[model samples]
Target: MLAALAVVALATVSGGAAGGWVASRDGAPGGTPASAAPVPAELVTAAGKTVPGVVSVLVGGAGGASASGSGFAVDDQQHIITNDHILAKGRNGSVTVELPDGRRFAAEVVGREPRSDLAVLKVPPSAGLAALPLAKPGATRVGEPVLAVGSPLGLPGTVTAGIVSALDRQVRLGDNRHSAVQTDASINPGNSGGPLVNARGEVVGVNTAIATIDGNGSIGIGFAIPIDQVQQTADTIIGKGG
Candidate 1:
């Protein structure tokens, strides 16, 4: 009887009856020198203008499977960009995007590239969907002030200020070469797929991963997918035959 049930459970999970699994840290890295800067009111104001594009994505399904993450609008048509891990379950689940003005809408996965951990979603166009301007990847300088905007730990519209610690940092994620923008910004759980913008409010990267330990949290080592790659992928996804 137990063996039969095990098989049934596996079949159900494989058949999209179970929700997608959330990504977790292996362990936190050791401490590093603080590089956080006082968030300027100007930066906050700039972020406020951009934050409307940053949205909270809620994925839900039957069998009590659900997950949440962040995403950003990339175009005037309500095209959204996010990490592939956030929408891995495909049509088995439903996605809802919540904007800063308390408006929410149903979203659909238009394209996904798991190797780069990027995905594109689509929703209906509405007012106040300010798309963030994309910055060149090689343009970001080390020690430059930056900010991370996302729903960290499910806190909507959360903003954290820090500096770009490095650029073109290579993080190996399961046979994929992820050239990332490293920052000292505090990116906790639920921040995946959000924007990592420079002081000018131009999006330089997409926050994807962070280093953490069992007891320690946010080791100051956070990684984001470069904006250039994001654009390339998004263009292909939104383009014809994609």
Candidate 2:
């Protein structure tokens, strides 16, 4: 029976008939009416632990154009992981990173891998830099609940929640081609390079790009560089300075 159908195609990522799936549902198994459970207190505490590692990144280019993005501490040595786009144009000028406690630092690019849109930056490690843990093996799966922590559109300390929409999705931005973890998280311009965290407060992905809905805002379709790739790339950059 062809019931009321809803075909969810990849809308803006690729301008083509990029295939879709039939969103058909049967019936709830249980007879009792169910109510949504309130969010757990542990989730709130997880966010509290994660946000301290997130930082706001501001870039100023020599041509006078400026941009803002997000990043998070990777280690106690002041190593940071963020989107390469944030440091793309500002290489010749200044890249300022601000912490959750209002401390700011001048960050220097250690390495940038544009293929994955990931970059590594460094500042002198001090007392306040806290490293957020990356999700371990077998820690994630499709439909798993997650959170996006970043500074969206210049507003810092922002956190949004959603579930993993899809996995191993491929998309391109400029010359960068990426296999991303798709989510319905509320990611925006400044959210790039921020952490896409799991419910366990572990960094699972790097929030990269979003598919625009209302002419340049998030309509809950966002893409992220999976943390496995982020970690591999970061280590190569750090150890080899490549």
Pairs of residues clashing in candidate 1 = 27-212, 28-212, 28-213
**Tens-digit lDDT string for candidate 1 (1-242):** 22211000000112221232322335545679589656687788768777877998777766656667788989888889988776653334887888888788998778878888888988876645888999875788899888899887666788888899998987876567788888998786677889999878899998987765442446678888898899998898888422
TM-score against truth, every candidate: 0.80, 0.81
Stretches > 4 Å off in candidate 2 = 1-37, 89-92
Clashing pairs in 2: none
Give me the runs in candidate 1 sitting further than 4 Å from their true place: 1-38, 89-92, 240-242
Report model 2's TM-score to 2 decimal places.
0.81
Choose the strongest candidate by lDDT: 2
* Worst-scoring 10-residue span by lDDT in model 1: 4-13
> lDDT for each of the candidates?
0.75, 0.77
RMSD of every candidate to native, in Å, equals: 9.5, 9.8
The digit string of per-residue lDDT tens for model 2 on 86-191 reads 7764543577889988889988888888777788988776636799999974567999888899877566788888899998888777755678899997776678
